[model samples]
Target: MLIKTIFAGFGGQGVLSMGYVLAYAAMVEGLQVTYLPSYGAEVRGGTANCTVAISNEEIASPIASAPDNVVVMNNPSLEKFQHQILTGGVMFINTNLVESRPVRGDIVLYEIPCNDLAHDLGSDQSANMVMLGGFIEKTGLVKMESVRSAIGDVFKEKKKAKEMNLKALDVGFDYMRNNGGKA
Candidate 1:
């Protein structure tokens, strides 16, 4: 039941926050979890990524060399981590922003219109949540209920963001359920 996942995007796209939320949700489920984040020198638009490992057993490290699942929010991230996904892994792409597809055929690919969906929900910044929703639906790594509960704890200070983020997450999950994954 070990799952190594990576979330990648620009710094302002909430990449790290998604990882944090995932780690927190895993904790709530009583799973062993580790989260590590890295960002480029430039803050807002710089490259940002986070690796999270969740398992029923002890986690040896936070680094994920070959992640079982990768969520890419932008084209650069798609290019950066596309080849790093393990065989039989799943890659969730924010199709609204990433125009390209993965070159590898062994891994599963799930295309999500994250930015557009978030905009439909009235907040483009919630794109990360949309991706998270799709990832959860596709992998069942964490229950949406756990994520919902974790959201309150994660964004307790930002009341408005909490509501929008929850909605965006629902949108992503529903989209994935309604539309099957593309390998």
Candidate 2:
């Protein structure tokens, strides 16, 4: 099986972190994975994105011209990458920050209020984790336990951060499972 995903948002939204964690989780599952990150010169507020490809067999390239999944964390990202998704692919939009919706009808769409959900969880910084959780739940690409462990590994020095991120992940996973396409 192979799945290529793009996570895009402003630099500070943890877009690269989302891709890294997903790639790490896939690696932990013994899957072949590649993560490529790109950002504008002025990070933080600038545009940032990452592409992650996970496959059971060898992958020919890390770049995905047409991704299977696109997770957009901001309106700019939504506008920029919405049309790059392959037909029948899935797109997860952060409704809290994105005002415009995709016009495509062939792709599956999931609207998630990631910032709101993370704020309710105590920190908006965990919004990326929230989106990741929902995507994982929808795709079942890697086990949730693997993601938890990957989060622990990523934030090994900060216990509270790890806990909060894990909670945020669980919240997103549950939100997707319960709400499906609705936010």
Give candidate 2's error at residue 44 in angstroms: 1.1
Candidate 2's displacement at residue 20, Å, is 0.5
Looking at model 2, which ten-residue stretch has the lowest summed lDDT? 174-183
Candidate 1 lDDT over residue span 137-160, tens digit each: 999998999999999899999999
Q: In model 2, what are the clashing residue pairs, if there are any?
A: none
Q: State the lDDT at 165 in candidate 1.
A: 92
What are the runs in model 2 whose C-alpha is more than 4 Å off? Answer: none
Query: What is the Cα-based lDDT of residue 131 in candidate 1?
Result: 87
Q: How many residue pairs clash in each candidate?
A: 0, 0
Q: How many Å off is the CA of 81 in candidate 1?
A: 1.0
Worst 10 residues of 1 by lDDT: 174-183
lDDT per model vs. reference = 0.91, 0.93
Using Cα atoms with residue i matched to residue i, what is each candidate's TM-score against the true structure?
Answer: 0.97, 0.97
